[model samples]
Target: MIVLGIESSCDETGVAVVETGAQPVPVLRAHALHSQVEMHQAYGGVVPELASRDHIRRVLPLAGQVLADSGCALADVDVVAYTRGPGLAGALLVGAGVACALGAALAKPVLGVHHLEGHLLSPFLSQDPPEFPFVALLVSGGHTQLMQVDGVGRYTLLGETIDDAAGEAFDKSAKLLGLGYPGGPALSRLAEQGDPAAFKLPRPLLHSGDLDFSFAGLKTAVLTQVHKLGAELQARKADLAASTEAAIVEVLVKKSLAALDRSGLQRLVVAGGVGANRRLRAQLDAACAKRGVRVHYPELALCTDNGAMIALAAAMRLQAGVQQPSDSYAFDVKPRWPLDLTAIA
Candidate 1:
């Protein structure tokens, strides 16, 4: 089956095509993405109105690019899939409306996919895909969660952030250091130049004996340190950045391990934008290796929101017989859909 997927969840617009049933797992034929980082950079964050408008302009052209790259035609697409929720309502509507329009035009079935599920299942598209019954750490800009996954659509939320997520901590801390938009990557790059131990940062709830996470406190700590640095903040920005990244990574790595131990799962899959953090990956790799536990992550390119993950998720759900695409063109989006709530009914 040929599935075309569209993603316009937040600051990026993505499109892709996946071929299912030709192999044991679905294969990503081609995908295209357009990041609004540069556009949003001017505003230091995403503007919902601008994001929705950009998605309107970029989704179709990118979908065409994906089809051309995949050597497929629009008429050949059997199912049209789109990220249906947990994003900007306007952005979600753009993709949902466009997808339904396409499905109606082609008389093809359409499927609405949970955005987080796309991230959780993205690793399946990697070269060294993980098997079932794995623990997933879905860390992104807007969310941080630990889930017990038995299979497609089978997810139990082990824990999640109560306040600011890890990504938010990174971004907020970087902003305190006067870093530009998309502060996480900027701070990380600077962190490479200084010592992580130069200034201590808080690791919230590291010993609360629960799996839940809290990064708001840590962000506050960074702010306090920035104030303390005062005139010297510029001279020590790199050290502060390193220290901030260290605190976040330590909490994430330890919490992930805790989730694995609690669930008695031997495999771990880390997905989402924050999963692309080099520090998090290195620490998790080292820690998991020491424990003889297998850790999996999507290719760095796929770590961020993308159409490939959505298409792959839809195909997997279909293969598992957990979802039935609808022929009716009428559709609605859930901007706050929960992953656990997405369990097969």
Candidate 2:
């Protein structure tokens, strides 16, 4: 089966083609993406109007590029898969409209994929993939959660951030330190030269003995540290950055381990943008290795929002006999949606 996936859930406009049902697994024919990070940088955050307009401008062109790169015509696509919700309504509409229109034009099936589910299944797109019934730690800019995945589409939320997500904390702290928007990556790069022990930041709720997390207080701690050090801290940005990264990584690794222990799942999969953090991956790898458990991660480039994951997810859904919505089917975007609502099998 050939599935053409469209992802416009956020600032990224992505398109891909995947051929499924092969012996080893599905094969991704071609994948293309256009990121609006540069455009949104000036605003220090995503401006919904601009995001919507960009998606409108980019989706069709990206889709064309994917088809051309894959050496397939539009009619060759058997299914049109797209992110249906959990993002900006206007931004999502662009993809949804294009997907539905394409499906109608080609007389192909149209499937609405959940964005988070796309993230959860991302690891399978890599050379090494984890089996089912694993523990998933989803750490993104807007969400931080731990889930138990018994199989595709079968998820049970174990715990999540009660306050700001870990990525949000990174960006917020970086902004305070004079870093620009999307500060997570920039701050992480600076932390490499930082002395992890230079500053001691609070690990809020680290010992709460519960699965839930809280990073709001940790950000506040960074604020207080900045206020105290004033010009001195600004002069030593690298050290401060390193310390903050270390503290956040420690808390995340500890909590994820706790979740694994509680769930009794030997396999762990890290998803979402924060899963790309070098420190987090190292700590989790070490922790899982010591415990004789396995850890899985998406290809680093796939960690952020993209279309390949969505296509892979939709292909699996089709193979599982999940029905496609009717031509009259129409649903609006959801700024917030729980993953457990949809069952894969």
Candidate 3:
């Protein structure tokens, strides 16, 4: 089966095609992505209106590029898939509208996929795909969760953020340090030049004896330190960035290990944008290696929002017989869909 996926849930406009047959995993034939980071950089954050408009301009051309790159014609796709929720309502609409329109025009079935689930299943598209019954650390924007994934569309939520997610902690802290838009990567880059212990930062809920996470307190702590620096904030920015990153990474690593121990699952899959952090990867690699746990991640390019993961997820669901595409052309989107409840299986 050939699946075409579209993702416009946020600042990126992505389109991709995947091929699935007898293989356990779907093959990504080709994918194209365009990031709106540079455009949003001026505002120091994403503008929903701008993101939606950009998606409108980019989605179809990207679709054409992906199809051409994959050596497929418009008639080849078996299903049309698009991200349906947990993002800007406008952005989600752009992808959903385009996908359903395409499905209708071609008289093909359409499937609406959960954005986070796309991230969760992305590792399967990686060079090192994971097996079933593994722990998944989904650190996507605004979400930090640990889930036990039994199979495609079968997930058991272990824990999630009580307040701010780890990604928010990084971005907010970076903002406090005068870092521009897309603060996470900028903060991490600055961190490399400073000592992780340069300033004392709290690791919130690290000792809670549960998997639930809270980074709101950590952000407040960063704020406190920034205020204390006063005139020296400039010279000390990098140090603060390092200390903030260290605290966040330590909490993430320790909790991930704890989740592994509690779940008694030796395989770990980390997905979502924050999963691309070098520090987090290094810490996870070292910790999981010592515990003899196998760890997997999506290719760096797939770590952020993309169409490939969305299409791959839909193909996998269909392959596993857990879902069926809708023949109806009338479609609606969920801007706040939850991963655990949205699975069709």
Candidate 4:
């Protein structure tokens, strides 16, 4: 089945074509993505209204690009898939509207996919894919969670952040250090040049013997350090960045290890934008290797929000006999949907 997937749940307008076969094999023909990062940079965060309007403008063009790149036609698409919720309501509606309209015109089925489920399953599209019943660490700008994935649509929440997500902490800490928006990548680059031992930051709730995470306190700690440094510590910015990265990575690694041990899952799949973090990757890779466990990550480009993952997820759901939304389906954006919802099955 050829599935056309649309993802406009956030600042990115992503469209992709995915082919799913009966042998549990999925192939990506082509995907096109347009990011609104530059537009949101000045605002220091995503403006929901602007993001939604841009999606309306970019979705069709991106979809056309994907079909052209894949040498496929609109009539060849077997199903239409789109993000249903857990994002900016307007942004979600933009994609939902386009997908529903296109599906209706084509007389094809439309599946509403969970945004986080796309992230969790993203690694399967990679070369070194993980099997089911593995541990998943999902760390994105808006969410942080560890889950035991038994199969498609089968997830058991293991742990999650109680306050700010790991990515948010990285961005907030970067802003305090005078770095611009989207701090995860920028702060990581600075960390490469500095000593990780320069400043010791706390690893909150790491050894709490529970699966819950807490990065809010760590962000506060960074703020306090910045206040203490005053103007004279500008020269030590790289060191601060490195130390902060190390602290965050340590907590994540420790907590993930705990989850793996508790679940007894030898394979770990890391997803979400923060899954692209260099230090976090290195730490998890090394830790998992030492414990005789395997680790998998989506291709670096797929770590963030994109249509390919959404498309792939939709294809899987269709293959699994998941119900399709009705023609009279109304747009419903879930700004706060839980990933463990059984209805998705």
All candidates' TM-scores? 0.99, 0.97, 0.98, 0.97
lDDT of 4 at 74: 100
Positional deviation of residue 317's Cα in model 1 after best superposition, in angstroms? 0.3
**Predicted candidate 2 versus true structure: per-residue lDDT over 1-345, tens digit per residue:** 889999999899989999986544578899999999999999998999999999999989899999999999998989999898788888888888888888888888788888989999989888898789899999998889999998877789998999999999999999988899889999999999889899989998899989898999989988888899887986788988989999889988998999889998889999999999999999999988999989999999899999998898898777766646446536466667788887842
Poorly placed runs, candidate 2 (over 4 Å): 323-325
What is the C-alpha lDDT profile of model 1 across 161-271, one tens digit per residue? 999998899899989999989999999999999899998788899999999999999999999999999999999999999999999999999999999999999999999
Indicate which candidate wins on lDDT: 1
* CA-lDDT, candidates in order: 0.94, 0.88, 0.93, 0.89
Q: What TM-score quantifies how close candidate 3 is to the native fold? A: 0.98
lDDT of 1: 0.94
Candidate 2 clashing pairs, residues 3+ apart or interchain: none
What is candidate 1's TM-score against the reference?
Answer: 0.99
Per-structure clash totals for the candidates: 1, 0, 0, 0
Q: Write the per-residue lDDT of candidate 3 for residues 82-169, one digit (tens) a residue.
A: 9988899999999999999999999999999999999999999998999999999999668999998989889888899999998899
Candidate 4 clash pair list: none
Rank order (by lDDT, best first)? 1, 3, 4, 2
Per-residue error for 271 in candidate 1, Å, reads: 0.2
